[model samples]
Target: MKKAGVTPHIVHVSTAYVAGARKGVVPERSLDHDARWRTELAAARAARESVEWDSRRPAVLRRLLAEARKDHGKSGPQSTSAAAEERRKEWVENQLIEYGRLRAQSVGWPDVYTFTKALGERVAEETLIGVMPLSVVRPAIVESSLKHPYPGWIDGFKMADPLILAYGRGILPEFPGLPDGALDIIPVDIVVNATLAVAAAPPPVDEPAYYHVGSGARNPLTFRGIHESVREYFTEHPMPDGGRGQIKVPEWTFPGARRVERQLRTGEKVLSVAQKLLLSAPATKRTRHWQDDLTRQQDKVDFLRKYADLYGVYTEAEVVYTDNKLLALHRSLPADRVEDHGFDAAVVDWHHYLQEVHYPAVTATMRKATVGRRTSNSALPPLKRSANGGDVVAVFDLEGTIVASNVIETYLLARLCDLPRSGWPGELADLVRKLPRYLAAERRDRGEFLRTFMRRYAGADEAGLARIVHDRLGDALLRRSHPEAIRQVRKHRAAGHRTVLITGTVDVLVQPIAGLFDEVVASRLHVRDGRYSGFLESPPLVGEARAAWLRRYAENAGALLTESYAYGDSYSDRPLLEAVGHPIAVNPDPHLYRHARSRRWPVAQWKAYTLPVGDAFLETVP
Candidate 1:
């Protein structure tokens, strides 16, 4: 520090990647890439505020929320507001990384890591050129060890380790790299020795020393060479995949980055289409497994995309670093210490190191954490009477559980299915316009959406609406009902355990299935003189209110809340599910599924059914 007064000799350990995007020979010295460090700093400092402003935009917020909860099988948000905040942070962080890369490349660098490090060097030199005696040690890719700290001791994956692991695990089928390009790998021990030598023998203050501690100059390793070594290692000692036999390693064609990325994009597009079709189809055991596999395939593609972006610059770059200074430093060591503490990389064997030490350490840490804790989809939780036998109840959420149809669909079926197809367009258009408001309210509290949307029924004849539900909506509800879910409801009833339906849909829509459960709890619309008042007579039974209502019901009925069972399909039903002894996710929405998986709770998909043409009414509802 400048303020320390006794300004200590400084040894800045920078990466050889500082030679970013530069080709041919790289000398251990300052580069002249015309980057405006001060300007870049100002722009980077203002990014968070800019991102905060962007997060508040309605469209961005909505998209991020959807991504956090429901875009493919990504782990859903833990809580709604918390999920929004978490997604906002992730979005902001990603934007910053992207922006950093753009600015870095604008000044002729590869990525954010190299760009910032270069800028930092410039800032340090400008501030402390004459104030401190400085020496810079630039290491290339630091791998496990050559002969220090015992041969194969490594904790986590380095930059190149992921590619190796992915290849071994059969996740990365192919990779792009220049076969003859210099991959300037240096053993961790060599880098350490080189740094210590520079620190011990500090350069003169005015003439700061620079050392390239890498293998590129003395003994260069090619991308093709490393690939062969990896292939051989994996082929001889194959990696196991669960209980399945050892995975086969695919051969690399050394395809260019453009080709690899193009193939990945095509694969991604196909998977996206498949996912959309699967979501639309009925939820069956086979379909659910296919969806899971799709999610994993998409993840593999994402992993390849990520590593290619992060590590490609190193592997594909043609530059060979000249490390004459480090070699000279190594030679100057005492005769006895030269063999032990030598910083030279020329004597090291890449084949022996990777095959014997590094690969084994990396693979040992890749075991799945969720392996023993998984509950099979086909296995149901044991059904038993509570200590207080009669108190045991099964609670099922209405939408996507007992019935795939939601509030909007049930209401629309009663309100508009009888109307001419020409009139349907106008009604749907009106619904579309108000959909955002309803969704926002629903996100805040399920009861709010029900309360606000139910206002549409005001002044309608209550008896007439009942007639509409009885004549049309009942059949629609049954048509969309999940067969296994209905079976569970009846199973609970037969066992003498109270079965309850807790929903945000109005009681009128629920009346059709009233006989299925012993108790029906739904939003009750107020009626004045046989005409609808368009307001809730009581607080809607959803979310935490529903949980509290169940508690009271259990207490009054001499039942135990802990002895009951709850099945839900929405994140809003989390509170209700948490109130029971057994909580099952029945074709759960993303957020609920994520929660359920984390807790190792039982998850099941109730087989969904297709209804007539107009029955896909709730598809666009939030």
Candidate 2:
């Protein structure tokens, strides 16, 4: 209104949560009554440009990526078109969320959403207060309508709605919440009515007018009460899940975040073991097909836990929203008009609303969606290599391709030596001893480093080294497989293409990942008379050498080179990638990232790392 040079009345709809990370009585007014946003806003803007902003992002992205890698087992549309779009949307949302989370952490907000909403209020107050009539209506958590166009009307799950739905379906095993804490949920119609009332009636220009359209002050609903109501309702009516009986009501747990994290990690390990065992089982021997179901349920559990972490603050808060302005406004409304506009919270029956309206509506909406659908386990098992042709194959680089870590370095430092490579005088001595060779290798070729590192394993018994790798480095190597890389590898296998692992790392080091592939191409350390030869049996299988190996293998197997796929992580793998019809740059180093962009090749960042792509890196993308 001020921008248009007119003093129009404005009703800015905001959230009562903007009161932020606090407890006790929260009045319908700004927290910073001294108006510190005038300076704080400037500081926030500057922080975005400051070095600290750039410095903090790697850690934030790492955390987000850690969570994103987990599967929530929700089955999305199987159609190719929808699947691609869904993946894109998920990626974009995750990126934006990570950016906002980092900003929130730096600026000291509970979360990005609330922090941004608070900033919006400041914008209105700083820019429009004196020039225009502004009425800020801060509504607490809004749910389906109590009474409006329809009693159970809700467009989609919002705020606490998902938890309510999950509870009804018996999926929410436990929720983190304070039993006595006020939930402060309000109906959509009441908020809308209050907003209209404020907009229509100007409450004296330039006066501080804030209305709390919430239920805590009048008809309160605690988190415990909400859960109880949902349980009771589902027990009575049950979820309309096409005859699939609802699971029992979940037990609520109020353990702290740290406890929850520990439990989740433990659960993940157990589920992972189950999944691996299921996958390893022979196709015809297993009595039941538990792989898909187990995978799906595991994903759902992870998703629920993540949601709990995101909204845990609200569930545990003890804030009571003061709605004096809202009550006074309702009283001033014409008696006849009150019936038309449902602004009263006292009339809302929580039990009836939950059972007769909310649960049914949410279930109906969910049923329309294709997500979380269970499929029959009637399909034949995965194809064996002997049953497949050699027409197509996928060549993958091991170190940065299959896993994010360099196995050679890890093996040398952690498994080979007696002294702890990561601590004390051992680390210092190793660094000092290897400093000259490392410098020499840098001045020479990339393979020089590999050769120098391999000398550390000289005269080591091959059998003893294999045992050491299995005992120490095996699990760590398997754990670092990039989700995207794994998906791509599976995609190729599903298409009946042979999978190959090619790397410069010696066979002993790459043993953990070897079984996943049909053939492994790697440098082999030569031994004579069961003693040190300290020389490669063959040239290091990297760069042009890797490409040559692929060509020779393709020719021998009669594989269609142009129909094959390859994934690599560095510029050195350019020859291997260029040799294939389909090439992907996975977790690329700086040089390869630019080259991939220039060539319009698809790029994927499977792991978070601090690789600078020049000063414009952060600016050039969201």
Candidate 3:
């Protein structure tokens, strides 16, 4: 309205959650919690310069770090300086997010989303008071339509849908929420009707009208009621279990936050110990399968913990909205109009809505959503390898060791999809910020960074990705290929050794260069209906996983481990290098250089655009 410079009546669509963290009867009025939010907003704005604009927040931070490093001198040993810079940047970004979260939670709102909404109301109230007639309608959680054009009209998963979906799937065994607390839900149609009614009759000139369009005051439905109705609905219309018969309706145990936190900590420790034990043991197919399962379970635990941490407060709070203005407006409306609009919340039957309409609609939507998605290793067919009866093998890490640059990262940050080149600066800043995460992956779980990074290709088609590699990344990668590395692989081929190009990059991208090696052991991305499922068919073959695969291949093909040769260019490749008798770090990063020196290993720098190593060097083994 301010930007438009208009005196037209405005009906501002806002959340009833402007009540903030205050309990008891929440009157339909403006938010009064400004003391905390003001300080928070100021602090947030002050640190805004630290953040670079990009699609993903994490990626943006990474790019900023990279930029900082580039701005600083890059010569001699930069490991210490680079590490410090990365840590500082990571710490700043983390602190900014943490501070914002804390500031939001401190003022009774569960998250910044709701808290910011309340602040927006303040801005409108202050700025648009004299210019236009304003009526702010604060509606509670808007769910699917109860009765309107359709019985259970829904577009996508809304606020509480994920929790409800999890419950239906028998995954959410427990939730940290108050069963007795009013959920304060309102239908979408009612909110629209209420907005229209308020817009038709705005408050007196210079006086803003506030209405809470929710069911909590007159016809409250508690979380316990919602849960029971959903459970009954699912029990009657049990989802097919494929092979496990009927999936039992998950019995939720509403534990306190403290209890849940304790359980989470304990469970994490147990999972960690088990994972370590599994890692220490032999990397057979059975053991690897178990490890993968544990990783999935760990992912679930992490998600649950985060969900509880963010939303648990909402369940605990018992703030019932008093929609007196909303009721008055409904009463003032024409009898015919009221009948047509049906803006009244008191008439809504919670039992019928949850059991008959909402739950069924949500489940149906979920079914459709799950159709073309893969959640298992069966998604991608295995890559058939020609049987090679050999006693010698050569393992090469494809990215830095062979190609000189990370082709997969380049594909993601540059040419994966046809995006605007104007956004490259922001993206580069994001990559710089994420360098710490990459370093962390190298330091600990090597595949962690790849797993998180590859999620960008979630909905891309398999064939399309191949075309991308062949057309865009292929020529660039081949050009950047280390001549020395190519010669080394050929020498291994001459010796009758099975040359394997192993990488965490998708096998499809690396398939163009497949003819250069006897076997390609790169990570295979799972596909469903020819589209990427955003999951690996197997654990990414990097770090320890790479070493394990090498051992397995050696044993299966009768290759001598003591006679095998491996070449890599990263700290993440340390395990692979250590597995072979001849371990060489080619164009090694600072971390890998230090590690190789400590181990008395040979480190070679391969110039991408320079001449290849002489024939004499290739003829003899170093």
- Which one wins on lDDT? 1
CA-lDDT, candidates in order: 0.77, 0.69, 0.71
Tell me each candidate's TM-score. 0.71, 0.53, 0.58
Q: For candidate 3, give the lDDT of residue 537.
A: 86
**Span of ten consecutive residues with least summed lDDT in model 1:** 70-79
Cα deviation in Å at residue 272, candidate 3? 3.5
Compared with the true structure, what per-residue lDDT tens digits does model 1 show for residues 161-219?
Answer: 88888898788877778899888887788788888889998877777788888888878
For model 3, residues 274-386, the per-residue Cα lDDT tens digits are 86677456434466457556765776677677677766777676888998888988999878787768589998988888888888888886666555444432211112222
Listed per candidate, the RMSD to the true structure in angstroms reads: 8.2, 15.8, 19.5
Worst 10 residues of 3 by lDDT: 377-386
Q: Which candidate's TM-score is highest?
A: 1
- For model 2, give the 10-residue run with minimal summed lDDT: 70-79
Could you give the candidate ranking by TM-score, starting with the highest?
A: 1, 3, 2
State the displacement of the C-alpha of residue 69, model 3, in Å, after optimal TM-score superposition: 17
* Higher-TM-score candidate of 1 and 2: 1
- Superposition TM-score, candidate 1 onto the true structure: 0.71
Residue pair clashes in candidate 1 = none
Count clashing residue pairs in model 2: 3
